[model samples]
Target: MATTLLLAGLMLAQSAPAITVEAQPGLDQVGYQALSAGRPDLAIERISADPVMSASDPAALINLGTAYARTGDRTAALARYKAALTSRDRYDLELADGRWLDSRAAARLAILMLERGKALALR
Candidate 1:
């Protein structure tokens, strides 16, 4: 159901990718791997290395923010999300199951931060 919603949301493209798929080389894989490896610091380093790239790829910015959030750094996480909001560029992320996801990084980050805060409060 969430995947379906993501597909529906992605039907609308605000603009073409800032960096073409071919141009990014292994960044996507590297970022994903870094995040999956419990190395949010590395993930943030790689993803935010290029501000332009991060600004363009919603996935990267979201991941970058996620990295920060995982480290309990809400300030940096929110900064990345706010930066993502400044641009209209959205990325079409193809999942392993062939589903595509695309959405507003800032909005997603807002929800994530809220959830993180709630989680902390409960603890």
Candidate 2:
């Protein structure tokens, strides 16, 4: 029974789709690191501190949205995601482990996942 359960768990893990968030070169690394470390409050504080940088950068918006989502602030998260979704700027956003995606596409995916109650999949 143990072997069977272990095999099943492995299979499930392997089959789960990998989730990725958009990254921006000019974004605040400290804020990004906070978000990645699962410290949403810290991420929000650091990101918000740089209003100039975070204001016009869609990538920063996405990161803020992700942080808000992590904190269960769906309204704030959705607002940020929506703002990012309308941006015309393009970026070589990192999607997965060594994989890249367009920033706009990443924002769309994040919004979809959040709306579908899969906000936990985002990070």
Each model's backbone clash number: 0, 0
Write down the TM-score for model 2: 0.69
Q: List residue ranges in candidate 1 displaced over 4 A.
A: 1-30, 91-101, 109-114, 117-123
What C-alpha lDDT values do all the predictions have?
Answer: 0.46, 0.56
Per-candidate TM-scores read 0.56, 0.69
Report the lDDT tens digits of candidate 2 across residue range 6-114. Answer: 0000011221222323233344442555655556789789778878645645666777786777777889988877777776655555433545556666668768867
State which candidate has the highest lDDT: 2
Candidate 1: global Cα-lDDT? 0.46
Winning model by TM-score: 2
lDDT of candidate 1 over 1-115, digit per residue (tens): 0112111111102211111111143444225555555556887787777777676655555556656766767787676666555547654444334564444533453446445
What clash pairs does model 1 have? none
